[model samples]
Target: MEFSGKLFIFLLLPLLQISTCDAYANPIYHACSKNFTSDNLIQDSINKTLSSLLAKTSLDSFGISSFGDGFFTIFGLSQCRGNLTVDQCAPCITKATEEIRTLCPNSAETRIWYDHCFLHYGTTKFFGEPDTSFTRVFSSGLIAADPIKFNYELMDLVYRMNAMTVGIDEKFSMYATHVSKNLSIFATAQCTRDLEELACRQCLDKLSEIFSGSCKYHLDCYVLSSSCVLRYAVSEFLNLPVSLSPLVFAAGFLAAGINSNLTGGHGFLPRSKADVMLNQLPEKSGSPENRELTAGHLSTWPVIGGLNHFVLVKFISGGLTAG
Candidate 1:
């Protein structure tokens, strides 16, 4: 009886841990326009537009589609963070579409923001134009060690990253890491691919100004708009690649120290625990090529399984005319 109870505990514990580790991917905010109601034709058009976006978004992480004619026409766009794989991007967008439909219901114009993706659909055409009217600024809730010095460094880093991002081939994504006073700063600036280079730069610069105006003392902050997003953190929160990936060294090193705290010292396990388990797996006494293949698999498992957490502090201002 004692041995059976112990085995049961061992099996059940991992399952419980797995359940707790799954992060809740909910919409941070949503807005529905009371301007128009959707009839059957408009609703069908909306459905078709959303389906097209879901079908094509996985290719380059961006999709735009329009359907119907006259007042019933529906235009939609979906975009995912650049660092996410198609597997990750697809699900985030799928969930956004599902939730936005329920949240906004019959409203003809609506937008929703999730942790990894954003979706928008409406009767009005909004492509190519920058939408800075609806903005949200989030802070990490921790103040910088030196507000003045940190603000200067933060702005400089953001400007440099924006320049690099606008110049990237066609991907239109840029991330940069800066270390100051033993603190690491990870920043990513991105614009919708529909925008031209000048527009992207202007959109990011305007977001940077918004961040500087309101949250200059914050250790970490995010300025988000319908057309662009800028975020930076003291800890490595982004899953960028090693050459461009901010979390590689930080995840490998600080994960051990931080994971325990995140898990409350018991009951749950952090995503990096997968790496430790993979390393402990018994190796086959096989050829060098076989061993190399196993090693390659080991390196990628953590990225696939890892979970990231984000805390949002939203400040909503009055809406502006679309520019």
Candidate 2:
């Protein structure tokens, strides 16, 4: 999608969304095994593997390392968002290493996501592979005035980005365009650098399917997974040079009703224990009868500069959390 002329106007607004905050230390989501290692050798390998991966964060935005021999070997991978500078990426990874250790303690394998970076480690080799084992959906329940047209344009932007990311050396893409005079969208797609073209394509395709199905006409929506992430918002969430100004997007959006659903399956570690988060962040209620999250407790629209600026997020069936 080409840049829209009016799109430049929104760039002046201050970025207030939690997902786009500059402080990258805030944890977004994580998945870890309930099982902890009792062997000293295996625990040593995990520490070595994580330290090696953390060291590389200063050099580039992506790194993968394996430490130890035989079953004791620990494989680790770390990557910052595609647009981050070394200064921004390094500390995010550093904090992730510290936070994961504190949050999960001695789990054999774990994965953590911050706004600017992702870190994962396990005894098994998962490099160059696509994993959709766990999925989380965040949608702004605000429906578009013209749902059909908005979806057509949104898919166009997403598919074009997917094509570009897989074809490039850096498997990441972001863009912004005007859907209408009063409406604009900013989106991004990314895969771990360890993923080859085929693996990256596979991961992104799974995210696309979720976007096509559950995230149809919402003004803003994003699906997060272990291997890839697909997100689009009415406001600019990326770290582009331009600052978005507060604009009257649509009044009906502020009053939109919550639409929620539960898809049961806990990624790779489905039977793992209930997710352990810092400060015991609110999680989707674990009830067979109460399947939906009401706006009274779990749902909210955080206002920014007199505008309902943030996405309407739905916590899917997984250990999901927001910073």
Candidate 3:
């Protein structure tokens, strides 16, 4: 069931009311569950796998090696923000390993992002290729006061970050930082190093598009995946002076859809009839300037013998000024 924008906020109270709780909504989750290696059983050999991969890792190389007795091909990847070091990346991996399962619950695989790092694992080969369906997008109610200026500063920062990625030793990540005219932005993009540079850039380009699709107006937002994360915010979310380069490669995007609101800034629904209810945006690149913001949260339940799921999203408005 869906809720009217007004009813949703009053129910939430005390806050802007942007809470999201998703089930294992991924088709990949279903496929993995059908072949899940019971967690109780994994306890026996997971230690051996962890020990071997941890033995020979270095600053530039986070290599995956086989474990004791050669029974499993264990691959683990640890990606901290591009500017981080062993001191940061190492421990982040340890904590993320424990925390992600708790967040996702009983799913055979999971991915979680901390401000400093991200982690993911599976029994299958996920070392290469970009997977779009395995993703989630979230944003807060706040928006940068001047998105045009924000976008200008952000573009320069990400371009530098892309350059740094281009000079990598075949291990790739996309990242950038720009503190322009007091509108600071820091963002990062990364992928498994095993992927060829072309594929890595392509994967990251897909994420860049996803970031713009989901949170371009947020001023403080991030999109994370097991493979990479794209982030940009107007505040100093991290405490490092980033020095990365822009991509000297090709990474194109597939077809995309965008949602914009006229009331300063609002949430973009990948699918919605709200766009139907409102006046249309101009064919040019500008957004509307005097409308309402719609933010929302969702909860879901399974139905139809696992073939269908029922979802309930409650949308809230920050302000409903009349045009």
TM per prediction: 0.66, 0.68, 0.53
Distance from true location, Cα of 100 in model 2, Å: 0.2
C-alpha local distance difference test of each model:
0.59, 0.63, 0.40
Candidate 1 global TM-score: 0.66
Candidate 1 C-alpha lDDT tens digits along 3-37: 11110001111111112113116665577774545
lDDT of 3: 0.40
Please say which candidate is ahead in TM-score: 2 or 3.
2
Q: Give the alpha carbon lDDT tens digit for every residue of 1-323 in model 3.
A: 11111211111111112111111111111112212355544433344434443443334325453332333333445455444455545665555555544554444344455555554544555676655445545555566787777666665555544443433433333333344545556555556656666666666666666655566666655555555555555543433232222111111101111111111211111122223223242222122223322112111222211212111111223323221
Cα error, residue 270 of model 2, in Å, equals: 38
Cα lDDT tens digits for candidate 2, 153-253: 88877776676556555577665556888887778888998888889999999889888878888777767677888877877676442323211111111
Q: Over 4 Å off in model 1, which ranges?
A: 1-24, 169-174, 240-323
Return whichever of 1 and 3 wins on lDDT. 1
